[model samples]
Target: MERKRGWDTLLSADTHHNAVGLLAREMRRASSPLYYPIALCLLRLLTREKTSWELPAMAFLVEALDCPDMTEWSDSILEILSRRLWSQCTEMHRLVLRGLVLLSKAPGMADGVRSLTPSLVELLCYTGGELVGMVLSVLINQVQDRDIPISTPTALRLAELLPPLFGYDNIHVQLLSIYLFQKVMELAVDKSKQLLKTHVIYSLLPLFFHWHHENQDVAEASRKALLRAAGLLKRRDLVKLLKTEQPWRFSECLLENDKRRAVEYACQALPYLESPQEPVREAALRFIGIAGRYMRGQRVELQVAINVIEDMTPDSAAVKSLALQTQEILRAVQRPQSSPGSSSLKISSRRCRIGRLLSGAAAGGQRRTYSGNPV
Candidate 1:
């Protein structure tokens, strides 16, 4: 205990990393009781005054795991964490778990990780949703040993835990899960089958349907994660959820404030949702109105509006003009379809047709009055 206190005090001075490095070196030879103190010290130093000390502290933990004698301490470390899993405060337990994650990156820590998996699962089961999110972050980011790899069962556990964390009660937790899912998508690209089998693909819908989170950070993260999952699953149905909802939500976002950024994301997200369907076309048109007007005749917004109209217009010139304004706003689409050969020249031809029709009607009305006078 006295030695532990001495090392703890040394970590307090923050003069240099040498003491921390020396302590990490000695931890390999230390007994089971000392692991907690040593782990606690390294975790402290990871957040020391100098940000540069972080990687060295992390490396120190990795190296300690490489020591041949460390295996004997694995069971005890797991036991300590397991007991503290429920009783301890969230932050303190998370620190130790973070260290374990860093330590698991080393090849020699395979036994350590295997021994602790059960306890980690227990934490996932019993902790608050945010705590589970923290554990998921560490797992998705740090646990990358091919030998001690993430198993299907473990991934399923993570997927099951995500729904509640991202459901609505905890915003921070939802944001963190979004980030984790993005990472998982990148890492598991080739393992799409296994990833989907684990129900990682289905896990995202709760965030979309259940929580209408409009906060910028959470919304952005959710967007990226859902897009990634959509790509992995290669399912149009999954993509539909985002496609159907995001534009209206974005338009609503534009109305509130920061119309510029809202418009920007709306533009970036549109092509992903494009389809040869009425709902998509109609929604795209609605978004154009919101985004176009919000951007207030910005070139890109105008161009996007023109493109949507070109693709979606009916034959009526008045309706076409309604959908596709040529700065005059009075003209409306009158045609259901424009011929491909004449579409480029159709605008001029359509104007002439309307002009001639009006001219002939006026002439006929005058001739009828003259005929009545002569009789």
Candidate 2:
């Protein structure tokens, strides 16, 4: 009774210097049962004051209250701290998050902290790397233990929250964000599985090709996650993903496992041959050259390849060389019974005619024409 009276007297005093020091000292000496009421009083003071002094007092109390055996006390503390998370005082908000972090580490306390997911995720949008890292660390622990997977609703909410972090400037934030995503990928099942694959995969595509990421671990993790996702995709989806101007960048990763699929992927590269970006055009042409053997019976595909190749200027030596090589392969496949020497002569004749047509078109002397032959 006297101790409670002392606390009340200190709190009621106009100057908080005496109360703050006394609370800090008592929190350290207080026995297990004494922590609950002390925590309540500290919370009450923090709620009422929002003073710098109260912030440290509450932090001290949180440290004292942090213990695995005190689940009920931890629960109460978390409940009060969660409310204080919305406090406009930045220092108070930070101290509360720190308290939550410490409490989250206690055994069996994650379940209680799990209720803070919505608030924590909302906090992520505006917080700095330090707080963001702490929040994510807590969340990572929440979903990581197999015996106690985070609820599906919370998992899905986390998935929705993760996409933007991919673009954050902080490397730690980016890496932790990806780690959380990888965990979700491993944990999601049933309907949640469909949600992650459909909504999250698109956002992850850019990361797959982050080959220049300064951190090799992040780059490697991105590659593993992308390949894992690729394994889940169908041939049609792979082709659809390749329809962009730079499909070749991902082709080796996405289609290399299957030869027939790689050939079909090459067919999709035809449109990219005209891409304004030199690298895109070059990769498209190179893919066609490698897959030329499969273009034997693909007459329309061969013609498209030949037409795009013929459009290239002589200055683009790399593109023209690959184009001619691809045309030669198509010619050999067209006439399997013919001798190599004859095929070479035929290729030379076709090249001369195509060159004349190109020069004429360049000179505005005549409209370009196609023989529509495989060559």
> Highest TM-score: which candidate?
2
Give each model a TM-score: 0.39, 0.53
Off by over 4 Å in 2: 1-53, 65-72, 150-152, 231-375
Across 208-255, the per-residue lDDT of candidate 2 in tens digits comes to 333224466665555555544554444345534433322333444344
lDDT of 1 by residue, 132-227 (tens): 765665564454434234555555565566545554356676677667655555554344445554365345333332223335566556666766
Query: In model 1, where is the ten-residue run with the lowest total lDDT?
Result: 326-335
When summed lDDT is taken over every stretch of 10 residues in candidate 2, the lowest stretch is: 366-375
TM-score (C-alpha, index-matched) for candidate 1: 0.39
Error of 1 at 311 (Å): 41
Tell me the spans in candidate 1 whose CA falls farther than 4 Å from its real position.
1-111, 143-149, 183-201, 209-212, 236-375
Top-lDDT structure, candidate number: 2
**Candidate 1 clash total?**
20
